[model samples]
Target: MAELEAQAPTPERGLAVRGLRLAFGDTVVQHDVSFYVAPASIFVIMGVSGCGKSTLLRHIIDLQRSAVGDISFDGQRLVNAEPARRAALQRRIGVLFQSTALWSSMTVGENVALPMQLHTHMRAGEIRDQVAFKLALVGLAGQEQRMPSELSGGMAKRAGLARAIALDPDYLFLDEPSAGLDPITSQRLDALIMRMRDALGLSVIAVSHELPSIFTIADDSIYLDNQSKTAIAHGNPRHLVEHAEDARVRAFLKREPIDEPARATTNEY
Candidate 1:
């Protein structure tokens, strides 16, 4: 069982989940899941559909209760922290949901400014300036007047991302960002994530099932196994693809052909 104990997490560990177990009612979703995300690194959570990938994210973000384990960020324990502390910790975190989660009634600029409006006392001019900067950073410059319905899927994703960073969070969490995007658009989004990481030194936690995107952006990843109800593989995607001892892991990596439609092709030999 997860205790209500709160021990300050070490600062060097950007986000840490230890001995985590999750369940909904009587059904167990995950077991003993542990991982540490270093600052400025992109850590991916990957697994087959219904394999508890999103469940893990929910626990880390404190959106769902874990049956057992503890979660901490930047020296604060999220599980038993005071409401004020929890809110403060969450403000340093940003999340881009699978749907982009933009409001249809709001314009792009309004959507990006919403976080600042809610979280800070900045003047309207400052919010506008910050929105403009974030939009430019995401390659959506001058589209502030555009509606969510007006954007292509990729553009909408970028807008959602801009909103996520409006408060300039230290950690970012993306859930299946590449879902429903075309190959080129997905690759572009992956590159954008890297650029954001490099520019802002973000510690990113991404939950993804997209194989190509997983390999391209993740510095470290943990693969959850539905059967064992725990993580079956953890490491660099490239290294795991080549050297994971588990047959299931090797099979999963080999299941996709390199020339598959969604895979990015390179010109290099």
Candidate 2:
């Protein structure tokens, strides 16, 4: 397993979330969530099913507003910034959704090129070159002409990742990046993620429940509890498995039986 090397120190080049609260109308999902993602580090949001892991990702990306707290990227305010400023801030971040969210109608090349085209004035030829370069970085070279429907599940995920880094963004956010893949495929994806972090100096924030992937790639992690609707543990996943004070957190990390009765399973946001 390849380990992520430490990056050169750069002050203020990271993400900060302070007292974040998530809600949908009268239903408050989580409250008082706070975490920091250091520059070029891989930070993971983890928990059991229905713990609002995905919902927290949406808030950080500004797709959904938080009920309380502030989010900052490299010292720039993300939440409640002026629209133009917020948009500018967002352009520096990239996201790969759980579904990949590639356009079924477009070829993989087109998908990768879209962000550059929309955000920059690069000529068509330059975009083409960049698209190829990004695809190659994800081990998807020569796959430009293939449509999303033509890609297998793993290919589609890589394609989506290619698109995510298209603009050379500083931060990368992934939602359930290893979901539904076999163990080998998942391990490959985990390796790819570490490579991206090392090669690009990206601060990565991922929402996931896959224990293997979590242990393999995460430099830091926070476990959100569904019942408490807040983070119960925060640290390296491996450390937490053995040392977490919360029994629920330890049980989840170690895949042991929880003492309490199971709650009705609900879809995680």
Candidate 3:
């Protein structure tokens, strides 16, 4: 495990976006947004259904093309980086989708090992051990051969998380951690996310509409209001609730936070 920890990339601090833009024909998704994601920060990007937060995230990861602006990771421009350098940069980051996105046909161990197998030439036994260690790290020890179909929804998300953390990524981008989770499961997941963030020293980019999740783990956030066509607010969610000057931000914060499976509390604790 020491080698794995050492294998982790040099922790990159901060992500910069300037004049970022994205549009589809006549429909614009993002409108010249600019912000900074501080290092090791669980920076939540929140918004209503059509505000383009996710689209902006995709551009950060280079998964989608931006119409204009600059996105740099630790000073390396994601939009303009050379191919090989970009590939190296990407290996240091990991992503978790709204869906668990596990391969239904593979076992837990197989799923976790896929990225390593594709990226390295490690022999079979070593890969197996690595898989076991990663699963254990995520509290899923000894469930290596279980099929994805057999997992509960929460377990599936945990498994996906295990895979995401397997490489000990320096930066993690999660689309939605509590999208479909029950309150208890979401709480458990939140604890795990914080634990892993500390344990692995990762910078997290979390996207969600769930204010509870944002408040519990986020150090800061960027809120995009679809009607405003810009990030209506940015800062600590707790502070934003009481201090934001924008009407849209006040309305957004005042709305009761809700999630399926009914969480125990709505405050971001």
TM-scores of the models, in the order given = 0.92, 0.94, 0.88
Q: Kindly provide the TM-score of model 3 when superposed on the true structure, using C-alpha atoms.
A: 0.88
Runs of candidate 2 with Cα error greater than 4 angstroms are: 1-11, 261-267
Residue pairs with clashing backbones, model 3 = 216-268
TM-score of 1: 0.92
The 10-residue segment of model 1 with minimum total lDDT is: 260-269
Residue-level lDDT of model 2, residues 1-269, one tens digit each, is 00111121223768988778888887778888888899999999999877899999999999898647878899776766899999899899999999999999999999999999999999999999999999999999999999999988899999999999998999999999999899999999999999999999999999999999999999999999888889999999999999999999989988998776576656556
Model 2, position 19: C-alpha lDDT score: 79
Distance from true position, residue 205, model 3, in Å?
0.4
lDDT (Cα atoms) of all candidates against the true structure: 0.87, 0.90, 0.80
Tell me the tens digit of each residue's lDDT in model 1 across 1-269: 44433342345558888888888877788888888898999999987777888878888888987646888887677877799999999999999999999999999999999999999999999999999999999999999999999999999999999999999999999999999999999999999999999999999999998888988999999988766789989998889988987767766666643222342532110
**Model 3 Cα lDDT, one tens digit per residue, 1-269:** 32332233432557777777677777676675777787767888987766787787788888887646776678676666789998987888888888989999999889999999988788999989999998998889999999999999889998998888767788898988898999999999999889888888788999888877888999888888665577778898899988987766766767844332443543220
Q: Residue pairs in steric clash, candidate 1?
A: none
What is the alpha-carbon lDDT for the whole of candidate 2?
0.90
